[model samples]
Target: MTARKEEAGPSGLASALVASGALRSDWLTTFNAVPRGMFVPDRIWPGIADGTRQNPVVDRVRDPVAWLRAVYSDIPLTTQWDDGSHSGDGLGQTPSSSSSQPHMVFSMLADLDVTDGNRVLEIGTGTGWNAGLLAHRLGGGNVVSIEFDPDVAEQAGENQRNAGLCPLVIVGDGRLGYAEGAPYDRVIATCSVGEVPRAWVAQTLAGGLIVAPWGTLYGGEAIVRLTVDGGTASGRFTRSSAFMRLRQQRPDLPRHDVYLKGREWPADGIGSTTTLSPAEVGGWLEQFAIGLQMPGAFWTVERYDDGTYTLWTYSTDTLSWASADHEPGADAFHVVQSGPRRLWDETEAAYAWWDGQGRPGFDRFGLTVDSDGERAWLDSPDHPVRCTDP
Candidate 1:
């Protein structure tokens, strides 16, 4: 192991996570027992180390200090991008794969409530840290993990072997949920899924639990914990997390210029009757609501030096919208929004409804799976439409 990784092992990481209020005594024991450095590489992106714009490339094998900080810190250490075709070797636009930060992994595992005898299936093995953790908590034979990329799966398998974890790692689509070993007690996905796959619910035994990162086509990401009831499973948002987009459902990497061309405004014009910014509105709904309403609205938030902020969202299907914190009396941003869906508006409405319910959110929400389709709320299971809107 690199000296930097050596420094972060056990004590340093334990202290950092504990102080951050993200570590519990039992969980900390698990974190300490497993060597995180074994699952990560000896080099990583040192984001804005000087508290400026420069994100220097640091080598753990070479720079012990840099390695220790990167390894121990709660921030996610990105591993691959563009489905491993493009390396994080040098910083760029896309982030394809990664070893999820320690806190996120611990949080999800804690939500799973797995035990020694539980059989687990993990989607998107990535660096295999989670699978290893599962294997450690459960047993090597009790875990099965799948990855889409052949190279990534192979690498993850090696990482698991190196870490002395014996999870049955496979290279294939995770949507199928490793049916060869059916009736898993727990299923967890590290990658973000656009929808909960039917197979996941089908394969999980009655009363099993599935904890995954789910969202809509647009971009609201949240961690969902669904408990399988008979055949269906449902739960609420345990926390908020950002993960690499699922391989099959990833959006096209659109150029900024293409979206900006010939932008049109709604006849109602910029000074419309809207109270909240698009992002704030987007966050109001579950990611599913945003995705169903706005098929491809991509958003970017930028902060300016003059203590001003700008939020921009572009869509190919719906009317694009932008709002700035300090407009300086600029004409209201015109929105030529025209569609039956009215994506953003619908998202806002859903948020309003959810908030109206005292923000019942996901914790109160439950899942019910049956012969037809899976549903989010138990009371709504009898309704014609079962799936949650995104």
Candidate 2:
């Protein structure tokens, strides 16, 4: 009851999505039929439009109007936190499951490009809303969804049933796509992955599409739509996205202490000054382009009370670490490099290459996955993206 009442509903959201072109005309009917409200839970944390931050809980029993408005809004609703371990309506350490933003849902569905009678397999049946949407599009028998968490799968099934849809909801690892429904005409993943699972490619039919959110170790992610070839699947990133990382693929990165190894500020580290402010390279696209070249690298920030901060970059293996001091209203920034690899230098070089290529967006970058592994390319498969080695 504490939640401020707002004037919102499905019609307003639908109109906004339609104007934005994310709610395409072809899928308009199913979009309306499969109302998102049915799939949302009693209590939820709604997220910001373009950021990962979440708002206070809006419980259906306590604030039905607020809950209804949140369910119909274009933003995501976090249904589970810390893998369902956290409690008490406050934000959790990490968001585990969610009903994805309506805009993103329909956008990815558009990328799926499904036709009548096309068999589809979806990874991460979070709330079954997506599965319900697909089931409504094709028949219930044509859609299969996999969830790793048994509890989540059970709830998703209940939600689907309540919505009058019966997509096969299986409790299993999403990384290992359900083999029982092999040779699917389309495979879509609601969760993001560091690497595309080979099983997804193997299970998909030739010429079928696999649309999923893909990210790198460094940072930044985008939706990639791949066409399954005889053995491999290759395609370009369609749009920027920030979905919850697949539980299996979640990284256990090395600690900063491991990299420091008892060294204090600038200890045994070479000091250098650079014209490139750390702020210049913090944009989403910049991170994506740099992550393509600087594999096994990640960053953290240390802020000072006076509005200045240090951007700390580290190599996954603790072989290298770099720090850049960024101060407001400053033309130059100080940088220090230690260990074997120059992480900051590699990042700068990657950014320069992206700039050299006219700063191509997500659409210009492509991915090719085969038995060997996945490789990123600038425009086409032939022009493979080069890695900045130590």
Candidate 3:
């Protein structure tokens, strides 16, 4: 084992969470009862505190102290990679399952506002820590968790059993939501989704709450708390999030080669300069507003050695693409756009519109899902953002 200084324990971590206003007073007992350490695996890729980046793996048998510290820390720990298909000591292509950050767990639970006897349906039981907490608060019989990965579901079931919690764990698609547990008083999804599955809304009883992380293809995500009523659900966003997306709702994005279509940089494209710096539109709130305005669009960052970067935006249809060069301390930025749609122009317009609205944050935004479709709004449901064609 590599020699390293000791870190905070579970008690210290709990104290810190309480001080940070994440662990509520009402749920303190459950938090203490269902320790996250019990559910986390021995080998894990510890994630950074604020971002999604994960460090190298730490094995409990090889380095017990590091494992303990990772478990007690507020950050998330990636347990399985590539849907448990990749086997290695190093990181994999993508993180498929993980134990969510403790702060996000408690905050979303607070949003759920579960009662003593309220039956709960949880989607994506990755590590079973959430299911254990729900079972500790409400009885085990009242908590049901659904996981799409069979191995993940089995591991979660084993973890819950070892912790003396018996929450029913099922291996199935979360989008369909377990119908056997229909008419639940509360429904929560650990995964994010672009569209709220109608099954979830249909399963939830009227006046119940459905809390899930909702994001756009353009990037940026937030926890949405919707109240169900008469086949409709609408609520305001509680906080920003970056959870893994639901498998069924994942978008099919075209490859860069397909977008370029064998053409070189700026092939048959228009070139222009903008006074607006590309850096200004990279914030979490800015991305949320821009994504709300422009559907079916996504972005990526290409960095250069000289501390400059180009922000590339593309339509899912692989028809339009835009690139804006951002240099430090520059008032004007160069832009190149191609195809029928002008992505950069639409993005800049959305940013301008958001600025005109006093630069509203995530709290001001809300989402409504009904028969027509899902619509993002600001301040109120009636003021829906104008959706443009891709």
Candidate 4:
């Protein structure tokens, strides 16, 4: 056991979460029951409190104190990298699984709003700490968690057993919520998805709630708490988030080379300048607003050593591309557009729409999903957010 003086423990984390208003008094007992340390693997890459970047691995065997400190901190812990293919302790290209930030976990559970006998179905079991917490709160029989990765599910089961909680952990596609546990009172997803699976809504009770991290193809994400109503579900975003993309819903974007077609910079592309700096649209809320309007669009940035960079926007179909050049202390920035769609203009228009709406935050944006598919709205469902002529 790690000495209390060496590092902050559960008490420290609980106090921080409580101070943040994420760890509610109702869930405090369950939080203590399902200690995150037991569910965490021997090796992990600790993430910073506010951002997504992960630090190097901290093996409990190698350094117990550091591991304990990381375990208790209100931050994510990457448990699997590249779907468990990447070997050794070094960082991997993509983080596939993790023990989510304690703040996020409890906040989402609060969003879930479960009652005493409510049946719950959780997508993406991951480390099973969330499932364990739920199981501890509402008995093991009332909770069912599904994970796509078999090994991850096995480990999660082991962790649950060790923690003295056994929520049914299914090894299957999370996008297809387990039908065996149909008509659940609550459904929650640990991972983020570009689109909410219809199965999740279908399996949930009519008046039940589904809390999931939803993002757009362009950029930006937030926790959405949707209330299931007949064959439709709609709700506003609760808070900003940056969860890993759900594996199946992950978009495979076309490469920059495909858009360039082996041509040099600004080859046969229209050139223009705009007063709007590239930095203005890079914020989380800005991206979410822009993403809602700009469908089939995504962005990447190429930075230079002289405090400048080119913001590249690409269409999924590889038919449209845009670039905005950003330099320090400049009122106007150079812009280029190629192919049919003027991606930069669309983005600017979207940003303008958001700015015109008095720059409302995530709370104002809501999503409606039905047989007609999903539609994002600014204030009400009638006024759907859509692309404007740029």
lDDT of 1 by residue, 1-390 (tens): 645543545687777777876776667666766777788777666432212334556787778877777777777877765566655446655666777888788888888888779999999998888898888878899999999988878888888888777889988889888889988999999999767888898889888899998765566667888888776676666777778767887776455444445555333324433554444453534554444344456555567887555554555444444433434344443322333334445545655655565665444544444566544552243422222232
In model 3, residue pairs whose N, Cα or C atoms come closer than 3 Å (at least 3 residues apart or on different chains), thus clashing, are none
lDDT, model 1: 0.68
Listed per candidate, the RMSD to the true structure in angstroms reads 5.4, 3.0, 3.0, 2.9
Question: In model 1, which runs have C-alpha deviations exceeding 4 angstroms?
Answer: 1-7, 19-21, 46-54, 253-273, 282-336, 339-390
Model 2 worst lDDT run, 10 consecutive residues: 47-56
Q: Residue 165 error for model 4, in Å?
A: 0.7
Q: Provide the overall lDDT of each model, using Cα atoms, as 2-decimal numbers.
A: 0.68, 0.91, 0.90, 0.91
Candidate 4 lDDT, tens digit per residue, 1-390? Answer: 965552478988988899999999999999888889999999988984222354778999999989999999988888888888977788777789999999999999999999999999999999999999999999999999999999999999999999999899999999999998888999999999999999999998999999999998888999999999989999989999889888998788788899889989888789999999999999988999999998888999999999999999998889889999999899999999998889999989999999999999999989999999998897899898986432
Clashes of each: 15, 0, 0, 0
Backbone clash pairs for candidate 4 read: none
- Better model by TM-score: candidate 1 vs candidate 4: 4
- lDDT by residue (tens digit), candidate 3, 1-390: 996643567787788789999999988998888889999999998884222354788999999988998899888888988778878987776678899999999999999999999999999999999999999999999999999999999999999999999999999999999998788999999999999999999999999999999988888899999999978999999999988888777777887778888989888779999988989999888998999989889988889999999999999888899999999999899999998889999999999999999999899999999999898999999999887876
Model 1's TM-score against the true structure: 0.79
What shift in Å separates residue 117 of candidate 3 from its native position after superposition? 1.1
